[model samples]
Target: MDSTHEQRHPHRVVVKVGTRLVVDADGLPRRDFLNRMADEIRDLMDRGIEVLLI
Candidate 1:
């Protein structure tokens, strides 16, 4: 595909979250990190990119 096509269209992304990054010592979700990630994902969405989190 041409660079212009890529620049004009939205791209799909698969974001794989590591277990360590998603869980804490007690096996709980890390809210702070999740929140930061959400913010980043929101930014990407705003730019017309699709994000799939795993």
Candidate 2:
């Protein structure tokens, strides 16, 4: 990725979520939040957007 102010071309985006956010405070998986996130990502994908998550 370039850091120049006048040249901003992002061909891809990566979103990183920590385990605490993706999981419960107790360390359990959060299905509801995951589902909601999936929905939102799908919405973006439908618009021809590409997302890379880790």
Candidate 3:
């Protein structure tokens, strides 16, 4: 392993986006929120974190 590489401790993460956060008052999917969350999840994956999305 390279000296500058980060070591994984837990090695995995679970991301549960609640219904309230994922939907509008009309029960529709919020595009902006979903896009933002997707970006964040991608970032975690890029960092070598295993993401379990629900």
Candidate 4:
């Protein structure tokens, strides 16, 4: 069910990205994963959410 009330978004978001998350087991960087993450961050910003990527 959907609420009849207004929806609110977060004022800010802090993302702590682990090196291992964006890297392969053999130590190679994962470009696809990074691109997806970047897109997500951009979406957040579009919704007026301040993103701090670390």
Candidate 5:
């Protein structure tokens, strides 16, 4: 796939990460999950998508 051709116009997005998805049973942030989520957000940003995390 040609990444350069995939560039998109900037847009806004509101992503609400659920408590359960972001925290563990002990009420601690899950590093691995957070890392993955960060990657996803980065990708979206790179695609010119403005992400608003809640």
Candidate 6:
């Protein structure tokens, strides 16, 4: 058996964006915050990071 044939470590990660961060305290959805979060996610994807959003 070859020792170098082991499976690579998992790099995938799951990120949960809470409602509190996506919405205001008054339970109103915020577009500005959502847009910023989207941009950040895009940046991470550009770096080959696997992100699973729930």
* Per-residue lDDT over 15-53 for candidate 6, one digit per residue giving the tens place of the 0 to 100 score: 787765757556657887677678988887887878899
What C-alpha lDDT, on a 0 to 100 scale, does residue 23 get in candidate 3?
A: 75
lDDT of 2 by residue, 1-54 (tens): 457732454445577866757675556568876777789888778766688998
Model 4, position 12: C-alpha lDDT score: 83
Off by over 4 Å in 2: 1-11, 22-29
TM-score of each: 0.59, 0.55, 0.58, 0.62, 0.57, 0.55
Ranking by lDDT: 1, 4, 5, 3, 2, 6
lDDT of 6 at 40: 84
Better by lDDT, candidate 5 or 1? 1
Give stretches of model 3 more than 4 Å off: 1-9, 19-29
Q: Write the per-residue lDDT of candidate 4 for residues 1-54, one digit (tens) a residue.
A: 234333354668899887767674556568876877789999999988899978
The C-alpha stretches of model 4 lying farther than 4 A from their native spots are 1-8, 22-29
User: Which parts of model 5 have CA positions greater than 4 angstroms off?
Assistant: 1-10, 19-29
lDDT of 4 at 5: 31
Candidate 1 vs candidate 4, TM-score winner: 4
lDDT of 4 at 10: 60
State the lDDT at 7 in candidate 1: 77
- Total clashing pairs for each candidate: 0, 0, 0, 0, 0, 0
Candidate 6 regions exceeding 4 Å error are 1-10, 19-29
Q: Tens digit of lDDT per residue, candidate 5, span 1-54?
A: 465655544477888877766675566678976877789899999988889988
Cα-based lDDT at residue 43, candidate 3: 88
- What residue runs in model 1 are displaced by over 4 Å at the alpha carbon? 1-10, 19-29
Candidate 1 vs candidate 6: the TM-score winner is: 1
- Would you list the clashing residue pairs of candidate 5? none
TM-score of predicted structure 6: 0.55
